[model samples]
Target: MAVFFDAIGQGGSDGHPFYDSQRTEHKHVANGGDIAVLAGISYSVTDLALGPWIIWDSTLGDLTRKVSYGGVDMQPIGVIQWGGTAPGAVDAWTEVFALAGVPAGEAQVVAAVWGGMNSQRALRCQTVSYTGVHSIGTPIIASGVGNSAVTATATATAAGRIVGVFGTRSGMSGYNGSQRFLSNDGVGLLMGDAPGTGSPQGQTVTRQNDGPWAGLVVPLQAADTVATCEPLIVEPTISSRVHRAPRTGGLRRKVFKVPADFQ
Candidate 1:
């Protein structure tokens, strides 16, 4: 098994314009094996006025084939006739989905955020590859109050599994123009190994807040892998400034490989 993490793009700032409308490209490195699963998230403004949104689109090698997840609304605020209105400070929303049989080759994942008049948006994505039969667990959702951190936990039924987590703000009170907006939300993943004599049960795989996306890869031994994993939410420390990651200049790619015999 191999895990790849990339911060596709960030909006509401110079050079990164996801507020009005924008599309960012991320390169996927091929492992010469089948793609077991893929997941992503978008961090956008949580104000009810603009109405946050996020979506993903991908193209196989040579742009011959493509797949996409329809746009997702991240706003958590809602109104009812009897209730009048619900929580008004919601800021962000996240989701994870599975992919069909994607061949072993280079590919590209594109993330887009739009429909908001002057809101900020950011995107992050992950890709996993394995050789044997594997299953993708249902996506878990978690939330927090008056804070940026959030967490979700789930049990893994099979070994050699890759877990993902995405995080964003909710119910932001103030609204600013695209240039001054806060778009620094982040995502992270953690893995817990199966019970053992002396080894610790949980370990932090990867935690990132400076960028748009973060991922963690767990290589499970068919005989000794863990049965549960946790995905944690990381919120931006600085709310006033928009953090800019080092530009990729072009597509960015990363790869991790797990030994075949071990699993």
Candidate 2:
């Protein structure tokens, strides 16, 4: 009869020999897709104040997408709530709201929006009240500083959020303007800043690689680099160091050398 037994090659001679192996660990940001919230109402801002939409990214992985700027049209992926149309106006302001299921992290709240909209502007602001414990570098905190590095009238230290704060008007005066803004606390971290107590604001965005919108938010801008329409993020990945690796194969498949005639 032919023998077909597998060999359990040994490396040590103390009556027992073994090999060690392990699995690798990896980290990635949760993808924030199809999240819901309200954005804008059907009324008008009597004082012509800025509006902000607050939303969160699903994953905390590296932010990958196009570099969008202000005044550009953006489609939100969340539910929105507007107060309907104004009493006598055909097109009026709308109230927006959203909830980014992602918990607070070390990264700031990076966001982008359509610039030069007829009657919309994005601004970063502080959260006036929240159950979240945000680090000073979080987006909400970063949105409180003015471009001049001075404190704006609406700060976001204890419980505040940011708002879109840049834009100009050549015709409609109170309508056409910039629709996004970025802010950083004194410590240095860009964050998303929305408006009011519960407005719908977006944190960051990514796009499909093979689509037309690809150029808008792809190649993931490094968090340390400048801000574009794409969501700015620092992705996480698996890392390792060799303690003692087998040179011939992977961890799951290994072999051992035996002394001649030792068995």
Candidate 3:
């Protein structure tokens, strides 16, 4: 019962139409636990019927949760078209969104773009840590197009249940604005057992997309205890730095000179 991967925050929004929206703030100095915030987005448009929206700011303690995905007729898994005329003629689009649990400390992940075109957006936040007695389920929007492999099953009524499968990549149009990290275009995450129920009951997790706009995190255990399907890379303890010095004495020193034609 140990899962940890903390630190990685990013935010962006240019070509402003009043600065659409963007936020990625992840700061956890240990002590607290149970947190998962994974988000992604990339955009640039001129209207191919324009579309791409995501908003997530899962606040904990006092409660202020929110979740939203793409719109304006969604159907994207990497689409492309640049400066109009005749290349692909779409404009630009990229979306890979995810938000889980988020109840640790300092975790603000948001992304938005509703109206007023002229867009250019980006947001990424990945911070995970869970140890002993965990529960976070409710977000399983699966569809990897051709379905090379995508599965997510759940059944852990009680008894040390640890299942974590996170994923992104929902309706992505293209223009290649440098193709932001979708796991480098061949997404993969595995934790087996759910094909014929031959193990100690049942618990499965698998994802292998080879396009772009992707996201994944699979970790399961408990429910008769027959676990595998584990690929939730964790690495991030804490390291913050900031130091500057040049003042030590408590005395005073004053000097007044002349001005010889701007010497």
Candidate 4:
């Protein structure tokens, strides 16, 4: 029977490709392994991609890239890849979030943290064509810029559902000092693969690699490169304690502690 079904393997001995091809796809404790980033890269930034964007940690204090020339707004930590030479590396590791090797170079800050539902089937694209088109990016409009450019006509990437929305401080309010705030609700691209929205303070998400922390992360700056961390993340250790991610992605791996008389 076809050599006993290729000796019980798939397309065996070393040709395995019968279908699905199986591929890949975290940390922060907020994304996996621990998660923390802060060193350099963030002024006009340079090269980075993976999921979610905009992370002000407080800028200068670290985690700078957006808020434009100053950084104050917040949201995004779900980069999951990039940081090969060190720009903060948001990489979640799955072949360096694809593009391969030393994460193929790129990443600086954005390892996702703030928390709540993500993963979107590893950011599938399938060429693009989101069926019913309730939004095409993520229904209900997340906000940033793109508003359109998601093109490609058909192949199917899943087409979203519970997409994110809330920027320009959708709830508004800021002030922490050495940077590092929190707030809430940011990442999206949820059900049926719906909606779309980039950055403009509206919510920011789209440098297009699929949108929403899938790309447009930017930071990379370990002088030039290597040691890119990945095991999920956890190489700095600032943790005053906030880590909360895991509705589908991860983080919130646990580390509360703050009531020692309210610190």
Candidate 5:
């Protein structure tokens, strides 16, 4: 949605009415004059109309007022003047606050600014509050794991099953390159490997009764498959004393067969 920053003269002028500028119960600048306005996702406001003022985004359900603009007395609307150091430029700026009927009690300042020419340029405000947080989702075990404490075992005591892992950390590439250790006995752990130090060591894990198993498993390969293939026996053909089936055909046929013992 496009947000408008166009300003109309609040005085007598032949300008169209801005119905959506403020709340429905509140009155907008009627019979306002035409003034140059800027609007966009990356637009900046001045101290005059920006400071101590109530700013609104498309998603805001209620009007939010700012407590102070650049540490000055709070006002519903703020005005700023830039280029004070520069000749013939107004460098002073003010911020206006928007109050939700109640004054000085539990009011939220949606926006604010510090005093100075580079105040808006400071870009110190937090954008996360407006954007909201997002989850990366849980990670899946790529391999089975066994107790790392044993160190002697080559693989898990039993066929290890993957439980869960993290896809990313803090919205960034999560521990992707880092070595991960996990135990089914609630001993899953991740560690960062530092240079000059021996390989990263697994931290002790305390398994909870309701947590994963005590033994952890990780895949040596990208995916898991059956351990071994069974052999098939063949009898001699009509002319040959003994004949063996074709490796490909024999394995395919043997694998395709349904067990007679299966109900």
Candidate 6:
């Protein structure tokens, strides 16, 4: 459960391919050797081989930063690059925090989340028939999806679940390439696809048939237009009793519930 990133001498790797427009796969340089190597996630860390990834924490209404650790009882909130703050909450910071392991808090124990921004993100889909060949720029949608997957047959813009498009060529499931990502989402969707034990509950994405997720799926081929890193404008948690979508800017960190929270 060590959240992996690219290793040295690599750009994009398997398992974890999530990144934002603010930074590319090369941002993870090991040394200033002018050689852009990937510092993919490992149980390893160093001044030269690390990241500036940021994340959020409300484990107890107190925000804490983490590094190089994974959680068994929590799903890391998305990297909080563009800082944000929930109403009556603290403002986010510019420093990036990796999705590391965290401690529990009173009732506010950490849960799973990854605050999304206008950053590129890929989703994993089970093997399904395609409508012809899905190429780059082919818009994706979902139909009353119970989880994060495209349905049989084909879809269009504003139709069903509006997941992102194909970063690479594809006619079936798992179509991401080296620089592309769908595979990472695959692992996340299944939570490492732990066999026999079954995928963790609530790990499945739910769409209300025609219900649209009001957020942005940063495309793999978008431009970096950010002038400077700024604080994220998080929507206020109006009622602590009713936890809603936590937004960064245009993206919402998909929420996951820890079994302990319910049981």
State each model's CA lDDT, in order. Answer: 0.32, 0.20, 0.31, 0.20, 0.20, 0.21
lDDT tens per residue, model 2, 151-225: 112223323233322111101112111222122211111112333223333333221111010000000101112
Once fitted onto the true fold, the runs of candidate 1 whose alpha carbons sit more than 4 angstroms away are: 1-19, 32-34, 46-89, 130-133, 146-149, 158-162, 169-263
The true-versus-predicted C-alpha distance at residue 125 of model 4, in Å, is 16
Question: What is residue 88's positional error in candidate 1, in angstroms?
Answer: 7.1
Q: Kindly report which residue stretches of model 6 are placed more than 4 angstroms away from their true locations once superposed.
A: 1-172, 176-179, 184-216, 219-263
Q: What are the TM-scores, per candidate, against the unseen true structure?
A: 0.43, 0.18, 0.25, 0.15, 0.14, 0.17
Tens digits of lDDT, candidate 5, 52-134: 35132221222232332122333332222222132322212211222111211121222332221222221111100000101
The full ranking of all candidates by TM-score, starting with the best, is 1, 3, 2, 6, 4, 5
Is candidate 2 or 6 superior in lDDT?
6
Which tens-of-lDDT digit does each residue in 1-263 have in candidate 3?
A: 33333444433233333344444333332224454433433343332223222222221121212223221111122212121232222233333344344444443444443433324433233322333324333322333333234333434333323232222232222211112223211112211112112122222223232322222222322222247788788765654444445446775444444333321
Question: lDDT of candidate 2?
Answer: 0.20
Worst 10 residues of 5 by lDDT: 124-133
Top lDDT model? 1
Off by over 4 Å in 5: 1-76, 84-92, 98-104, 112-120, 123-263
Candidate 6 C-alpha lDDT tens digits along 93-163: 11211212122121111111233333222222211111111121221221221223322122222211112
Between candidates 2 and 4, the one scoring higher on TM-score is: 2
